[model samples]
Target: MELTTLWFLIVGVMLIGYFVLDGFDFGVGMALPFLGKDNTDRRLIINTIGPVWDLNETWLIVAGASLFAAFPEWYATMFSGFYLALLLILVALILRGVSFEYRHQGKGEQWTRWFDQFIVWGSVVPPLLWGVAFANLVQGLPIGLLPNGGWIYEGTLLTLLNPYGLLGGVVMVLVTFTHGLVFISLKTTGDMRERARALATKVGIGAILAGAVFLVWTIVMHLDHELLWLIVTCAAIAALALIGGFVANLAGREGWAFTGNAVGIAFALLTIFSALYPYLMYSTIDPAFSMSIEGAASSQKTLELMTWVAVFTLPLVLAYQAWTYWVFRKRLTRETITAGAH
Candidate 1:
C-alpha cells in the first residue's frame, strides 16, 4: 500500500486504541455515582483505575498528535469546526485530572464530593462529544474550500446537534458506561464485583442496541461505497461481540466479558473507519468539496519519516504499558479499599 494509505490505517488503529483503553476510564468514572453508593465503594472505584488511567490516556494523545501531523487539513478543519465542543472536552479533561489529586487532599465529605463531580463531568462529556464528532465526520459537514486551497467549516455547534450526531453521542456514552462496568468487575472482588457485573449486563444491552442502530444507519447511509461488504461483515461481528460480552458478563466470566466488550468496540470502530476509508471527511454540500485521505495527508516523505519513528517508538511504548498493567494486575477488594482509605 502507499504511504498515505498506510498512515490512514495506522491512525485508525491508534484511535481504536484510545477508545478501548481510555474508554473504560470514562466508563468507570460514569459508573461512580451508581456503583459506588458510599465512601468506601467510591474509593474502591477510584483506586481501581487510579494506577493506569493516566497511562490509558496516552492513547488519545498519540492519536490526536498523529492526526495533527499526518493530516493537517483534516486536523485544521475539524479542530476549527468543532472548536467550542473540543474546548469543552479539553476543559473537562483538565478538571478530571485535577479532581483525582484533589480528592486525596481534602479529608472532608464536601470536598471529596466536589472533586467527584469533576470526575463525572470530565468523564461523561468527552466520550459524548467524541462520538458526535466522529459521527459528524462520517455523516459529512458543511465544509468548503477556500481561495488559498485550504478547507473551512461553515457550520456552528448547532450544526452538529442533528439527530445522527446526537445518536452517536448516546451510543458513545452508553458503550463507555458498559465498558466501565465490565472493567469494574474485572478489577474488583466481593460485592463490588457483583454489582459491577450485574450493572454491565443491564447497561450493555442498551449499549448494544444503540450501537446496532448507529452501525446500521451508517451502513445504510454509506451503502454505495465500494467497501459495503466489509462494513456489513464488521457490523455483524460487532453485534455478536456485544451480545457475547453481555452473556459472558452474566455468566460471571469477567475476563471473557471484558474481552468481548473491548472487541465489540474495536469492531464497531472498524465499521465506521471502513465506510469512511479513502475519504477523511465527506462533504455535505458537494462531492467535489470532500476531504479525502490523499487530499488531506502530508507529503510522502513526511509520512515515511513518521512511519519510521512510529516503528521504533510504538513497540517500546506498548511494552512499557504492558509491563505497567502486569505490575498492577490483581483484583482489588472492598477490604483493601477500606484499609487504604483510613
Candidate 2:
C-alpha cells in the first residue's frame, strides 16, 4: 500500500480506538445522574472506570498526533477554523479530569458533592459539543481560500448550530450514556447492577430511536456516496446491538448486555466516520474547496516513515491496554468505594 493509504489506515484505527474506549467514558459521565443516585452508587460507577479512564483517552492523543503528522494542512485549517469549539472541549476535559482527582480528597461531603456535579458537566458538554463540531464539519462550513492558498473560516457559534448538527449532538450524548449504562451493568453486582441494567435497557431503546432519526436525516441531506453505504451498515449494526443489549439486560445476562452496548457504540462511530469519509472538512461555498484525505495528506516520505513506526508501536499500545484491562477486571462494589479501594 502507498504511504498515504497506510497513514489513513493508522488514523482510522486510532479513531476506532477512541470510539471504543472514550466512548464508554462519555457514556459513564452521561449516566452519572441516573446511575449515581447516592454516594455509594456514584462510587460504584466511578470505580468501574477509575483504573482505565486515563488509558482510554490515549486514543485521542494518538489521533491528534497522527493528524498533525499525516495531514498538517488539514490540521492547521481545522484547528484555526474550529478554534473556539475545540477550546471548549479542552476546558471541559480539564474540568472533568480535575473533578475526578480532587472530588474525593476533602473530608467534607459538600466539597465532594460540588466536584461530582463538575464531573458530570465536564462529561456531558464535551461529547455534545464534539458532535456538533464534527457534524458541522461534515455538513460544510463557510470558509474561503485566500490568495496565499490558505483557508479562512467566517463562521460563528450560530453557524455551527444547524438542525443536523444539533441532531448529531443529541445522538452522541444518548449513545454515550447508553454505553456507560451497559458498562456499569457489567462491572458491578447486586442492587447497583440491577439499576445499571435497567437503565441500560431503557437508554438502549432510546438510542435506537435517536439513531434511526439521524440515519434518515443523513439520507435526506444527500451525504457523499462512500459515506452513505458505510453509515447504512453502521445504522443496521447499531440497531442490532441495541436490541441485543436490551434482550440481554432483560435476561439478566450482564456480560451480553455489555457486549451489546459496545457493539452499538462501535457501529455508531463507524456511521459517523462513514458520513465523513474523504472529506475532513467541507466548504459550504464550494464543494471543490473541501479538504479531503488526498488534499490534506503529508508528503509520501513522511507517511512512509510513520508507517514503519506504527507497525512496531501499535501492537505495544494494544498489549498495554489489554494488560491494564485484565489487571482491573474485578467488579466494583459499594464497600470497595467506601473503603477507598480502587
Candidate 3:
C-alpha cells in the first residue's frame, strides 16, 4: 500500500515477467541440439522464439531500471557485489543476441555451429548465475556497514559457489529447460511437437525433483519468517504446478502444460520474494547491517512520481506485448520453416 512497498512489488512483477518469458527463451536456446536435428529444424526452433525473444528480454531491462530508480541502495549493493557474475550474464546475453542475428549471415556451417554453441551457453550462464545470486540473497550475504554510512560486501565470488547456491543454479537450469521444451511443444507441429512433448515430460521430472529440494530448503530457512505461510502456500502451488505440467505434457496437452509450467515458475519466484519481503538483502554478518525495504527505498516523492508514470505506461506496454504474441500465435512446422514462414 505504501509507495515503497508498491515499488517493491512492481519490481518483483517485472522480474517475474522476465523469468517467465525469457526463462523459456533460455530453455529453447539450450534445447537446440536436442530438438534441432538439421539446419532447417534448428531454424524452425529458432523461429519459434525469434519474433519475441528480444521483446521478452526487455522485461529484464525494465526490472533493472526499476530497481535502480526505486531502490538505489539495493541496486547499488547488488550490482557492485555481484559485479563479476553480472558481467558474465551480460556477456552471455550479448553473445546469445549476436548469435541469433549472425548465425544466418555466416558463410559456412562451421561459423553457424560456433554461434549455435554461443546460443546454448548464452542461454545457460545467466539463469544459473541468477539462481546463485538470488540463493545467496535468501541465504544471506556477508555485508557490513561503512563508517561513512554505506554498505560493503565482504565476501568474494567464491562465497556464492556454496552448496545452496549451486543447487539453486541447477534448479533454475532444470526448470527453465523444462519450461522451454514445453513452449516448443506448444509452438510446433507434427513430429517436432511430439518430440518436444516427450522431452518436456522427461525433463519436467527433474525440474520437479530439483525444484522441490530448493523450495524445501527455502521454506526451512524461513520457518520463523513472518510471511512463512505465504512462502509455504506458494511453494506448494509451485510443486503441484510442476507435477501438473509433467502430467499435461505426458497427456499431450501443450497449452495446459505450458500454462502449468508458467504458473509453477511464477509461484516459485513469489515464494522467494515473500521470503525476502522486509529485507532487500539479508546480512549474514549482522542483522543490524541488513538492508530493509524502507532503508533501501528512494525518497517518497520519487516513488510517487514513478508510480504515476507506471500507471500511464505499464498497461500500454502489456497490451503491445500481448498483441505481439497473439500475432505470432500460429504453430511453426517443417513445411512453414522450409517455405520460409517465420
Best by lDDT: 3
TM-score of each: 0.98, 0.93, 0.98
Q: lDDT values of the candidates?
A: 0.91, 0.79, 0.93
Question: 68-174, model 3: which lDDT tens digit per residue?
Answer: 99999999899999999999999999999999988888668999899999999999999999999988898999999989777888899999999999999999999
Model 2 C-alpha lDDT per residue in residues 197-266, reported as the tens digit of each score: 7887777777778877876776656554755776777778877887787788889887787778778767
Count backbone clashes in candidate 2.
1
Residue 271 shift from truth in candidate 3, angstroms: 0.6
lDDT of 3 at 191: 93
RMSD in Å for all candidates: 1.2, 1.9, 1.1
Candidate 2 regions off by >4 Å? 223-227
Query: Which lDDT tens digits does candidate 1 get at residues 1-342?
Result: 998889899999999999999999999999989998888888899888899998998898898899999999999999999999999999999999899877867868899899999999899999999999988988999989999988999999999999999999999999989999999999998899999999888898899889999999999998798999999999999889989989999899989988888998899888889988889888889989999999999998899999999999999999999999999999998778654452
Worst 10 residues of 2 by lDDT: 218-227
Clashes of each: 0, 1, 0
